[model samples]
Target chain A: MDHPITVDSDACTRCGICIEICPMGIIAQDGPDDLPGLVPGGAAVCSRCGHCEAVCPAGAVSARYPACGPQHLPGGSAAIAPADLAAYLRARRTVRRYREECVDRETVEALLDVVRFAPSGMNGQPVHWLVVHDPAEVRRLAGLAIAWMREASRAGHPMADLFGVLVRTWDAGVDQICRGAPHLVIAHADAKNPMAYTDSIIALTWLEVAAPSFGLGTCWAGFFQMAASASPALAEALGLPEGHAPQYAMALGYPAYRFPRVPGREPVRVTWR
Target chain B: MDHPITVDSDACTRCGICIEICPMGIIAQDGPDDLPGLVPGGAAVCSRCGHCEAVCPAGAVSARYPACGPQHLPGGSAAIAPADLAAYLRARRTVRRYREECVDRETVEALLDVVRFAPSGMNGQPVHWLVVHDPAEVRRLAGLAIAWMREASRAGHPMADLFGVLVRTWDAGVDQICRGAPHLVIAHADAKNPMAYTDSIIALTWLEVAAPSFGLGTCWAGFFQMAASASPALAEALGLPEGHAPQYAMALGYPAYRFPRVPGREPVRVTWR
Candidate 1:
């Protein structure tokens, strides 16, 4: 493959910063005066980590991002203070109660954009997102999940007790499934991929961690995820692409309540070798 | 579990904020001037999410944290700027190459402390950590993983091709298994726990995200994890508590290089329902 990056000679100083910065050592400058390009077979091995384009001192190294079109964005820095970050992590709560409001499209989009940088197995970013945006749609999906739980309960599944409790709560007009959250975000990938479960959960974890920064709240929608994995009806409802299946999900919305204190947890159990 | 919280009568304002904020509605105030305590059977249902103690205005309420002792800490606010957080997320990279220096114990401790707040299924918080602080130990464990891979390769295992590549690299001078990182952090839980995989991965995701905050870097040790799951030798080397098995691990250290730019990713894929 030709060089993934196109160097504009006018702006190129040929300093080789990109070559050194390339994580895969793919970018090469044949001669000190020549512009940087990918080494032979470089494209096949490139993880597309974007380190080359990011470290370029000159504005000349532009790599094609077929997904977003070609764009060279500067690397982000650790601007947050340690103390504030400590507080931020401590402040996060598993928000199960949400106000009857929807997060605007732009805000949700921005949050996903941040998590897009979350790492995946071998940089094989196989996770795709399915945003259940409308509250009604979320409600319908939750119903399908309940449908599975109800059947599982009748069939005496291993988790029958838990399913029975949830189904009863749902029947009693409580949403134990999605927790009445207005939005549900599902992370999915090709079911055949071994890394799908881990990558999807990692991406969702990133989303939940970053949600509060946008004044939003989230809870792991485990019940929905469990049903999505088991119930063909729920799978049909999700309508993921041809080979994709849901691995995990989160209920998303404006929090109706507040967690005003940092509750202490069990002393971390660690064995240092 | 007599009222997990102790309310000081003299300092109690009896505003019922605790009652209102309790996610389980377990906290109760008998009279307008009365101190708050758990409702009948409330303790049984309480998730110990700590919302009641956090929401109290008076310094009267203190929750007993066996893990942390009796303390009521103020809830942290979202003090981080959204833009800064966006940049922080973008700046993160999966460091495959690491500097040889070891991270101090205090820094590793601080990172784990922040992750203690990460959520778990049913508030189980079942994940425990094992930090391999010795580089030699890490190398030894990597050799065990290589041994498993070497056997798998000879047996023509399904992943034999991938295992072959890793084993060949290990036989070479390169440290392909642990990436030569000074420390390895393993997240483990009871093998019987259904939530172990998701919960452990979520916890490790928290760790990797929080690592950058401590000027530390991490790479998911998937090969090591795979071997640990299948190899009795690696499991015996791990020495996790009885019935606990390794779920995931990360190579922890300072990065050898810097990523100066944020590489472009494929455009975000979303299906709006």
Candidate 2:
């Protein structure tokens, strides 16, 4: 079979760089046109790595990702410039504290306007968002989340210590850590679908990236999401649809604190092939 | 728990727009610190949504994502201008096919370099990449993947029909449906961690958004990832660590075809609160 990306024979330079760079070794000379072409006379196999495309200096090759097609967006194809990407990547953060003010309905609608544009699996668009602004409802949900954590803790889950912190905070008459933030954006997808997490993460990432440009802070509330998924009352209060599982919950608000410098960390591990 | 952003009180106008615009209802009017200050007691729950900052006429608020901190990059704070954001959102896609030619090593390295900067759950950074370049190794892994599928088919799984297609394709001596794309980028994370998929998705999304800027195409390959996770031979061939589990995969290549128009889609369901 022809690889999803086919080379134009007319533009062939045969530099062999593609063969060397292929992470999967699917590209080869004199390969069968059918039966996954990289297998040698039905002997070899290709991993479908695009290293060859990146390595080719002749500009003679072209590649395509499957399942992606033209006309995929509401307004059509618009290119994101490098500068914009740099800005977007630089601005996103996971926020914890918030100012004690209420966000207006208009601004929430505006942010949703951009979030609706987030990409989905196979264009299935399975992602759904529940925006909670009422202080009472947010707190109620947080209570339910703590209850779930207590259950998990009793079960000896490894992260029980973290849950203990939340429990203690609530018990000490401190603010409800989960609901203290005024805006709770809960992202959900069909629980039955394997790709639900992917859908939620993709949408959440889009929202997080866009938030910085709007001057808001976001925190990925895994505890809340897990609790929502585990507790039907919390799910109902959050307005998650039946059969839809909450994958991520983000708390949005203004910052209550400041740091003098970026937190320190060890160097990252990276390999060059 | 202080949030990561703050507004300069001296620069405040008390116009009430920030409170109204905040998605998280953390902003409120209160006399704290012996002065009428926009106390951020609730800001600790911020999602970093950016609405308050974006709408602020005076630009008093500033937030910085942890990954884009001063120590990592030279910029004090980066924000994608509105026009640039419009362009970036427009260009995103999920590509699958690829050209037969090789991609430059430096270019692939550059892409990986950006991915290295992606955030992880609690800075775990458990995610690992298996870049397959050798055509033979790619083929070996693909064959093992097909074998796994065949085994699943014999067991009478629901996806038997899909596997039947693979069998028929292989029998007819045609190309693998995965395409003969020469490169495959596999992302794996710790199996024990709940955030493994989150880490993988974040890194992959970063790469996907950045690929178009370099004239490359990408497609997420969940099926391939599943196969690798389920089959030990495939996992070993791909060099996945003992405790690591595959979370996501993608095919990359040069585009053999281009469509003149962006694809159309149904309007996403969005609620404005």
TM-score per candidate, in order?
0.90, 0.68
Error of 2 at B113 (Å): 2.4
lDDT of candidate 2 over A120-167, digit per residue (tens): 654566777778777667777788888878878888878798778777
Candidate 1 chain A, poorest ten consecutive residues by summed lDDT: A68-77
DockQ of 1: 0.54
- Each candidate's interface RMSD (Å, one decimal) is 2.9, 8.7
TM-score of 1: 0.90
RMSD (Å) of each candidate, 1 decimal: 3.1, 10.2
lDDT of each: 0.82, 0.62
DockQ of 2: 0.17
